[model samples]
Target: AAAGWPLSELFDRQFASWLDLDPALDATNRVPSILNGGLGKISPVYWGACLGAAAAIDLYGLRKKRSDPDYFPGKLGFDPLGLYPSTTTGKRRMELAEIKNGRLAMIAITGFAFQEFVQQYAVVDQTPLLFKPVSDVVETYGSIGGYGM
Candidate 1:
């Protein structure tokens, strides 16, 4: 249980660190390192290839599902990237697609890390927290004056 706790704590800390990193830095630095180093600890090249393949599959699926009317303005169909006008309806569809796909991808990737963390720290009893959850810890020492002591 003690061993598991530390592993859980480490995972929680690392995850919080990743969340706090700047988006640009995350892309250029943290992401590759975590994906390659953390996940890579299990399997490096395999995970990297999996990430690339997943993205490609997502792009291909999106391209294949595009409607004819979505690509063609009146009668002429645009072949280059098949980009259409960004109307309210179009924007809404795009947003929905992105949200749906993004969520699935996030879940999939996070699930992998979570499994690894649990496996690595199977003996731990308590999980780590980014911040203290108890109110007393956050409150001032002198501020416990209200109500009944």
Candidate 2:
């Protein structure tokens, strides 16, 4: 049991590392805000674009995995948990798919957040002029031009 403990720890670390590198697992914070906010100051069109991009990323991962299951680590045989006596079976493949799907879900969630962010913060036209450059006025009108005029 003692010897098996170290192996288990190592496997856990590897699994975590692999998951981190998986593109499907990557989740940006931007998606959630848009979904929650639902187009305030920002444009709805931009939010839709962001959501579309996220969907594309997710689809890319699925397509890549389908094309080559071995594209990811632990595909052939490298059981992290040692729960299975052998990793060469349909069950192991299903387990891998489950893990991948979990990551995909996270990606999707974050993508939604990103869409929200776009809607909340993205600038539309320059009509309102939230914060124009004071320097422009200073330069055009001159710092002391008011007194002279």
Candidate 3:
């Protein structure tokens, strides 16, 4: 309403994109209701909390892992920092390494948050959306980082 950019079109495009993304659920047949089609509406709040936690970790500390080679999964060949020190040296290299590590960690955190939301909210009762039934496993059986059931 205030700006030149059309917010309506932005939402419409997102709606169309999601509808198209899931071939099983098309825009023609599917629409929001009391229970369903509200997936994108409600989950972002919770997901943002999860990502925020990751951001906080990066901002605060636990950066000891940045310099520690044993911290990263070298055995798995996953060098998150990519801090070879050949291209960059001294403080800049370390800064870049930390930034890189932080990004990778954030990605992992976001993905975990997405899955956690899906497991907690997406699948209902006992049935899972797919295999390896994670339905309420965390809330019912286990807890993450002392987040008990």
Residue 109 displacement in candidate 1 (angstroms): 1.0
Of 1 and 3, the candidate ahead on TM-score is 1
lDDT of 3 by residue, 86-112 (tens): 443564665566778878776654553
Ranking by TM-score: 1, 2, 3
Which residue ranges in model 3 land beyond 4 Å of their true spot? 1-88, 121-149
- Supply candidate 2's per-residue lDDT for 106: 74
- Assess each prediction's global lDDT (C-alpha) against the native: 0.44, 0.46, 0.43
Model 2 spans > 4 angstroms off: 1-39, 73-149
lDDT tens digits, residue span 24-128, model 2: 111221112335542353457867999999887777767777888565533434467865434468657777777888787777556534543554432211111
What TM-score does candidate 2 reach? 0.26
- Give per-residue CA lDDT, model 1, range 1-149, as digits (tens): 22332334336446656787322222212222243343333345667898999887666656655744353212233337766445989856765776787787776556544643444322122221222344543363347633112
lDDT order, best first, reads 2, 1, 3
Report clash pairs, candidate 3.
Answer: none
Specify the poorest-scoring 10-residue window by lDDT in model 3.
Answer: 1-10
